[model samples]
Target: MSLADLEPNSLHVVLHVRSHPPKANDFHWGLYLHRDFEAGGTKYHLKGADKRWLADHGTTRGVFKSFLLIGLCQVARIPSGLMKDVDAMFRTYDHQLNEMPGLTCRTWVFRVLELLQKPHSGQVLLECNDLTSLEYELLSWGNANALAAADCQQPRPTHRSDLCGL
Candidate 1:
């Protein structure tokens, strides 16, 4: 489906499990916004790994092509009619932050979440304040879903929104 098919103002955390060893258990995190969603009207994420990691893994940056989505959960909700602003903010935020040492998509996802929860953070809204718990819930959901490579990868869409079960 498309963003227009999702709930308005809803934000969900998207997780893609690494397929290779040595970091297979780890995941690349991203965000997905639903139709009329206040935060953003699209997916916000950093895919792929650093050059060295890429070289070692023989993979480039791209969803589905490089990794597979394993889990997702709704995390935040902003006010209606702010989709444009929030979408622009996230687009700029993604570029301004840049990828750095020790910073992965997971970092990007958490940073955005933190920003949305900051005091007086204009234009941004949240469904909850306890990110730690939200994170735990994601992990729990992943585990409960049996995060097996074969299980999570099969029977789902290759695109980001296909599995937007939210």
Candidate 2:
């Protein structure tokens, strides 16, 4: 989607998994914040690159993209300053190499999305086992989720409690 389409002051957070296989030191990524990532501005993310290959072309390699579409309550001015909380909450994720235990940029993005109460928690945005396989996995998951949502919306049969007074 075009950055211009985004309403003003709407913060967007995206997960960009690095381009590398598991067990590779270069297998890492980060949560990027920007209306238009390719346009570029102050982007936030964990910083690391063990190999030149990843370093050269790792950023923004993840094809799986999602949006937060921050509401006023999420980033609104409050008793605690908005920017203050924003910095504290987001900046820490950009910690230098190996600082956050086992969490990489990929995990960090997942956790951040979960913290914001986004769906698909604990799942990688761009797992690189096999591109074709991953596509099928995502499609199946999406279909199941849609079915579950549809089921929830279906009207339930009326119960005796509804006519108890009669």
List residue ranges in candidate 1 displaced over 4 A.
1-5, 20-25, 36-41, 51-67, 99-101, 119-124, 146-149, 152-166
Score residue 130 of candidate 2 by CA lDDT: 42
For model 2, how does the per-residue alpha-carbon lDDT over 110-153 read when each residue is reduced to its tens digit?
45544433222343322233433433433333333333222342
State model 2's lDDT. 0.31
The CA lDDT of each predicted structure is 0.53, 0.31
Model 1 Cα lDDT, one tens digit per residue, 51-92 = 222211111122223245664466656566665555655655
Instruction: Give, for candidate 1, the lowest lDDT window spanning 10 residues.
Output: 52-61
The backbone clash count of each candidate, in order, is 1, 1
Our tally of clashes for model 1 stands at: 1
Q: What is the lDDT of residue 75 in candidate 1?
A: 64
Clashing pairs in 2: 29-105
Residue 95 displacement in candidate 2 (angstroms) = 4.9
Candidate 1 similarity to native, TM-score: 0.64
